[model samples]
Target chain A: MDLRVEFAGLVLKNPIITASGTFGFGLEFSSFGDLKRLGGIVVKGLSLKPREGNAMPRIVETPCGMLNAIGIQNPGVEAFLKDKLPLLPWRETAIIANLYACSVEEFGDLAGVLSGEEGVAALEVNVSCPNVTHGGAAFGQDPAQITKATEAVKKRCGNKPVIVKLSPNVTDIAVCARAAEAGGADALSLINTLLGMAVDIKTRKPVLANVVGGLSGPAIKPVALRCVYQACRAVGIPVVGIGGIASAEDALEFITVGATAVEVGTANFLRPDQSFRIIDDLPRAMLKARAADMAELRGSLVLPGQ
Target chain B: MVVRNCREVKVQSVRFLGTWDEASDFVELTLENPGWESYRPGQFAMLRPKHWGLELPWGRPFSISRLDAETLTVFFQVIGRGTSRLARLNPGDEVVVWGPLGNGFSAPPETPTLLLAGGMGIAPFRGYIENHPTPEFLRLFFAHRVPLANYPYLAMAEKVRAEAMQEHTPEDLPRIIERIRELMDENHGGIALACGPTPFMRTIQEHAVAGGLRAELSLEKSMACGVGACLGCVCKNGEGKHVQVCARGPVFQADAVQL
Candidate 1:
């Protein structure tokens, strides 16, 4: 069966893409499996300057999911372009850079810096990181800021497709999706992570040093699907679903809810070669679902009344 | 300059041999080796049973306690939900393991090395003691709350000059600390390697630095991914910069990290 998918002016060999932050710079996992087998890789979030991130104990496992407050610790955009990008097999696969900045101007500047790079296929704007202290989920939670940030990146991004990654902590994900569309976002990816926290009953201390973190994994899959479905209906642009997607069946669930593609996030931690395995299993998953291709199954959800 | 060895790491499915109770709470697990490249002494691996579902999503990181021609051994105490589940595995059960990860202990072969460990901290020394070129020159001082019979002390003691101390109460800490200081004083100009609880490690680190002695420490942190991608297992360095423990080290120089 054909597994190719074209969305937001980019063609993926398959609908399987590794989410940002989880996949590192794409080189760390190269030893686990062939990097060329993946349809796309969204590298860790980059900023204008290197970030030290939060204190120790930045993650906590809760039930089937995990919460992280990494605070988008990266080596800055320049270091990535000079040191990391040259080593990736960008010629065969899409290398999307995830951007993190403290302000609209910085976001635009970061977009300008990466958009000119030949190896970077696209720019993923990270307005939904719940771990940082400022200018993260704040921009994603406010419709006006989301529109402004998307517009800022779009204006300076040149020909590179700008994907606004939205937050699930917001009240109405459709409103945020429409806001990005209003600012001319080529596509949208949701949801970044839900805000949550854990506590140690014995020490009476917060589990994470940052106290609150973004929740991801199988626990957040239903919430992610709900956000993606609402956002897909509200906007004309393609939506890439992310959040706790572990298996090909999970990827198909997002596709069935109107997502053009799905990004494997937290599962990459559970198993480094998870994305590659998902890609290999997609054709079999499609056959089991009795579909000719992704298009045949895209948004095929049935309503009870209908 | 200290040269660290880098090896190719891969995920493989191995068969569980069975569990051997080292003590009431501590157990040793043996697995069939699937022809993984040779691993150094202080390195570790992430292990998960194939039957595991979402209840415990990530694998637990364990120090490579011992490695023979055909089998790998990992020792741990029943700590939480993950270990509790791991302790119940049957023989021949399939388990997914990936490793020889993180930088391993690299004490200069010529130097007389003092292996200081506490409780479960003694896990990695079995391989360290057996694999050392000069096993005769190695000395181990293990401190714990339980009896010496509860640990792999005797097995390792046969390979090196091993000694054990029991800390029954907080008041017993100074006596153990005094023993460590005495060991450091006697082994002056030599190197010390340590692993254990934070305070125990901190005590060793403090004395090592104050005495101007070279020391290496193996740190433990709650890690989601044993790889560096998640950035979850980071600790501040001596320079106060955060470095990934899983990538930079689960083992670091005494002066390299804050504690």
Candidate 2:
């Protein structure tokens, strides 16, 4: 009956949190449902300075999935703290600030700045964003860079838990997972979209203006599951799963595979109240799996001992 | 209970009004009004179409062309797969729509309104002219590459009964500006409102700036979520700040944006 989850040291009401980029500043979706009822709100990815993202046609649709290159467009750290932070109902719900920067020092500075601010329960280091020109995928793809980014964030994040969101484009997700855990990450989240591209045959041009964009949604769910499963096995810290999670059944799959929590991304675009819908449906799914609480569902996947 | 006003995205079945080929690749869709009767002049609706297990995954934004108390209409050109699928549906067939969304045009009703429309940009102005409190003070300058054969323009002109002017030579920007100036002069402090291709809108913005004519423009962007949730439909302001076109203003003051 208790749906509470300890995600990255923060006690969330439920496991369903709105993914960073999809939820905007969390204020926009208040019209759809009660923000306080959900587990948490991960406001869109923020940077040290305001980023003007890519050109037009930053998104395209594939089979049951979507590709977006919305380059972590935010109002910078100062504006987010001054304007967006106060607007959040911090007393009622968990507020996770998803942070991105072009360099290790910038990541530390952003984390440091956010640490001093009240109401920010956790810091989600968005090193895996494929949309930015630099410092995003560059930091996520390599274990060394991932370790450095994690260390930078962990150093100045104070008592706030640091969650390093891993990129799926890497060859071995486990290696990056180990690196993040080695760098003192309290928890890990995967997968932050797969680097992919779509083409418009009629125009003989790439559909997204950036040519290559990060593909998310149902199309990448399988890949996400595999990565989350691998990352969970590789690291000792808690792992949060995100990718194409539209239903309670989808969230259960992640939990069964060892993800302590899940974030709903692209589904929010279609159904704004998806987090509440998934939270509402979670109990039925857990009951079907014969699990009394969410804690029992973690790593419950039965694999054949070959 | 405090009724929180949230935009609802639903799968409502819309009956095809008519498909006009003479107008060169344009389709008009009609749907029974869902709860709310009226939206702002330049506000739009999102169409959800699925085929071959492939969907847009998000609502496709289209300006509301015409609306009655009981029904709402939208006009769109076959630009990509989304609109192509919409073109295939028949009058009796059903298509899903999420509607009456975004901040629309804002102009003082007391001022004489000059509408500059290029190609299919005439869609939103139809609703604007119809919904205006004082319709007689409205004037339209519609530009197209060829002769006027579209049913929408004719239907709009007839329904609104306002002075509608046509320009066949679309490339003649100087002449269009001159015409706008003459209309502004006649109205004694009139404002221009335009919707069209980027170049057309840009030229209108340019003229509106130079002539000191207060203007508003409706922009077109490749959108995912018609609601403000997705940061996909962002347009840069004159200050180069990224503003959500769906949340802030699909219709914005001419000088506020970079076009």
Candidate 3:
């Protein structure tokens, strides 16, 4: 029944955090469920300057999932701090800032500004956003770039924990995970949507204006779990699992495989109150697994030979 | 009981209300009155077909064409996989719907109201005229390639006193504008509301702006969450702020949007 989890040194009421980009600044969801009930909320991806995002048909539904190329359309960091940050009920739950930029310095600068802000509990550096033309591919694809971005943020982020959200497009996720850990990341969250595209045959054109997008939903759960398993083994830091988590049982799969926390993304689109439903049902799931708390369930996966 | 404002719901009585062609369809659903909010004209709902599993993961937003105490009706063009699957729904099947959402039309009282709908844009006008204090004060102008008989709500439009005109080509838009101009001149103090494709609404907005006539518009966008959280259904207003159509609108003053 005690679902509390200590993720990256932040004690969450539960491990169910609304993933970035999917849950805009958080106030929008307050009407559906009690924000106070959520473990945390990773607000929409933010940057130093506001982004206009992509063109029309930014999203397209695929098999058991969706592809989106929203390109992180956010009001610049200053506007967010001045106009939007004040709107959140900081006392109710953790607020993790999902920061994206075209360069390492931009990431550091944004992290510094957010570090001084009163309510932010952590900073989620987004190096894996597949929708952008610049930083997404530049920083997330190379282990060296991952180390630089994570170290830059850690240096400027004051005492707040820094979580590097890893992209699933890489050839080896463990290499990136180790690099982030070496750079002093308090934790890691995987996997940020996989790169994919869908084409409309009638017009002979891709469904999204950007032509390609990051795939998310139940379709990517197997890929996500595999990545999480690898990343957890590659580093000493905690890993937050995300991808197709729609139920308590699904969340348990990640926790058992060594994810210290889990964030719900596309499922929020299907049902805004899904996290609340998952949280409420975790007790029965725990009973079924015969685990009292998330701690007992974390990293409990057994290997075939060992 | 109606689960008003509770975005997650399951409702039965999924009856296909028949269609004009394979491309257009109507699905009527009934929900208990408790837990749901009574909807206003111009508001919309999000519908999702159950049991399709991952093939259909999200809901599509539709204008609430009609609303009774226990039933809500929506009309959709079977354009994609979700709607195509919805087109096959049979009576007694259950579907998930949530809403009565977004800011709906605000019709000024006792004033003549002109409704300009392009193609399937006629969806919300039914709720407006039926629930109006003076239904006789409503007038409509619909433009679509299909004949009046094929228009989804032709019978309902007739009951509400709609005036129909045939547009043989896109070139007829200019002639249609001329007609709207004449109507505007005749009803000096009337309010105009328009909906349809972006290009269609843009044309109406330009005319309304040029003539200094009061107009409101309903916009359409690709929305993942029919709530504000997804930030996907954004529309730029006169101020350059990206507002969510599902939250701030789906309906906005004609002057309030960039069109």
Query: Model 1, range B135-176, lDDT digits (tens) per residue?
Result: 888999999887676678898888788889999898999999
- Quality class of the docking in candidate 3, CAPRI style: medium
Report the C-alpha lDDT of model 2 over B1-259, residue by residue, as the tens digit. Answer: 1122323322234343344454336667675554556678788876664232334566578898877776767887777777777767654444455556787776566668788788788889888888898777677777665345653677667754344445545556567667756665565477778898888788778777877778889998877777776778888888878888988879888888987
Q: What is the lDDT of residue B20 in candidate 3?
A: 61
Candidates 1 and 2 compared: the better one by DockQ is: 1
- What is the clash tally of candidate 1? 0
Question: Candidates' lDDT values, in order?
Answer: 0.86, 0.79, 0.82
Q: How far is B26's C-alpha from truth in model 2 (Å)?
A: 3.1
TM-score of chain A of each: 0.97, 0.96, 0.96
Candidate 2 collision pairs:
none
Per-prediction DockQ, in order?
0.46, 0.45, 0.57
Best by TM-score: 1
Off-target runs (Cα >4 Å) in candidate 3 are A129-137, B1-4, B7-19, B22-34, B90-92, B147-155, B166-177, B239-241
- Ordered by lDDT, highest first, the candidates read 1, 3, 2
> In candidate 1, which residue pairs clash?
none
User: What's the candidate order when arranged by decreasing TM-score?
Assistant: 1, 3, 2
